[model samples]
Target: MYQVIPPCMELRDHVSHFWFASWTAQQDRVQPVYYQTASCLAELAFAFRSSELVFASVQGHSPHAARYNAGGFLSIFGVSVFAYSLPLLFDVPPAALSGRFCTPEQLLGREGALLVEQVAGEADLPARVRCLNDFLKLRLRKAAEGDHRIIAAARQVMKPEVKFDLSAFAGECCLSPKQFERRFSACTGFSPKLFDRVSRFEYLLNNHRRFTTLTQAALASGYYDQSHFIRDFKQFAGCSPQRFFALSGY
Candidate 1:
């Protein structure tokens, strides 16, 4: 079963969005069989506003293996909180943050093991969240106030009906596509095109069961066609929408 828990407080204008999340299941606790295409599965998922980094631990089996899909990776071990800023902090990237993992150096932009120690030690999640909120507020304040331009631009380009054309966006952003890409890469660690695809794919999945038919779901999310939609869904989710959906309901 997948469950999403939203942050209890309202964030300042600068914060994108945030949530605490968990997913769990028992073999016989729910339906035993079901199926949907991967694209279909994309219609239902936990979408975050700001970039999110979570600290989690597993109890029974391999927590890492049990909790995430193929693209998920371990940046560190143990129950540690993860820090996630919006992709705007990175600019547009090649992939959405789902299942994406990075080295500590890549995410922090420096080498220090303090985060590790923080995770390994006793942590009061509520208190830690308070501290994290303070930290994010400080960072957001130091950065230029108001909505970041890059984030605004990215949001505009995220429409499901349109494919992200980097060259065009680069021109709009007033930088050569290569230069734009570099800035975006430094900020988010992935390319713009990939981010667009993944984000929209996620959008579709979040609304998967919301629609009456699979085709309706695909079209609503901006997939060029059903086949193309299914192809990308499998590549990213590691299962067809139908099967993934069935398992997701646990």
Candidate 2:
């Protein structure tokens, strides 16, 4: 079974959703692997009663097709944290955890480790949700304030319809270009310029149905030329636009 719910109202800005999923061993064997795609969002997942030391993950954007193979019976509860929310939620920078995961106990030491145990013992899904929410809310209190300037910069990148000039936007935020680049990269795992490229590619991918033709899609995505568009998509999706769309059944 699979289920998803929104975070409590207080955590909505930083958190995208909370999810739960489970499958039997036979089901796992039937559909054993899944591929990941380029994404700006970070995710945190917890495994329940699994053989893998109750796996905990806090991961960042993936640039390619990372694969995961299913094993045994599985149940997982997780949250999707917005990319900019890294600064609002964790002591670690977004770049620090990009493309990889670390144990909760390792990341937060004793408190995180204890919470993992408590979650395992919690009676029902609602109780477990509360346990996780309380932990996050408490940590949010201790976390440093998120840089609204950088958040705004990310927003501009996210909205490709707006004309964006990296240096000009930095000036608007009262940050030097270099300072803006550093802080944006630290929070988003991509510099403003690169994030812009990814955002355009993301638009192409998400709206693949309308972009049925390669030339039209590339131009519509704001790329200067078809070659540049294909190059960026290859890097982000691990495949050319044509190949990716065909395989994805677009």
Candidate 3:
């Protein structure tokens, strides 16, 4: 079973949501390989049964291939971290975390190491949730004045019908082209082009039910045509679109 909750109003700018899942060990529990593409966000995930807390960062800073992994059993609680909000969550910089997973203890020092044991000892999911929220709320800070505009521009590029023009958009933001590119990369971990590509792939992967056919899904996700869609699918998913959809458990 699983549950998901949006971050509180104060955290809406930095966090996407808080989610938890529980599983029972069984001889026949279904285990499947998952082909995951990159994202513009990072996540802190905890697997209580195994006493594991990991920071997952598949932020597509480069055009890398897909990441493959398998899942088994556990009780897990996770918070999705936004690209620009990394500093507010941790003293670490966002650029350092691209395309890798780090244990919280490795990233946060002794305080982080203690969090694993502390949050895991909570009596129930609600207790766990409160524990996590209290910890994060203490670290909150006001977003930088420029961050508001940068993040707003980034959001415009991810719209279903994206109409992005590098020079024009930069001018609109009152920044020179190079200045815009630099700030955009600093705010999001990737160049604007790579982020748009991976984000489109992420959108269709997560929102498969929004369309009934490949063409509909491709076009709605801002792809120019089927051929380009297939190319990115193979690049990020490590398989043809057909097999990606044909898998028994995703």
Q: Each model's TM-score, in the order given?
A: 0.57, 0.78, 0.83
Note each model's CA RMSD in angstroms.
9.0, 3.7, 3.3
Residues forming the 10-long window of minimal summed lDDT in candidate 3: 53-62
Question: Model 1 over residues 53-117: C-alpha lDDT tens digits?
Answer: 33332111000112333123212222111111342222213234333444333444432134333
Can you tell me which runs of candidate 1 are displaced by over 4 Å?
Answer: 1-17, 21-131, 143-148
Error of 3 at 10 (Å): 1.6
| Model 3: per-residue Cα lDDT at residue 160 | 66
lDDT of each: 0.45, 0.75, 0.72
Error of 1 at 121 (Å): 10
Which residue segments of model 2 deviate by more than 4 Å? 1-3, 27-31, 49-54, 202-230, 240-250
Residues 36-90, model 2: lDDT tens digits: 6677777777776553335666667655556677454378887877777776776
lDDT of 3: 0.72
| Candidate 2: C-alpha lDDT | 0.75
Clashes of each: 30, 0, 0
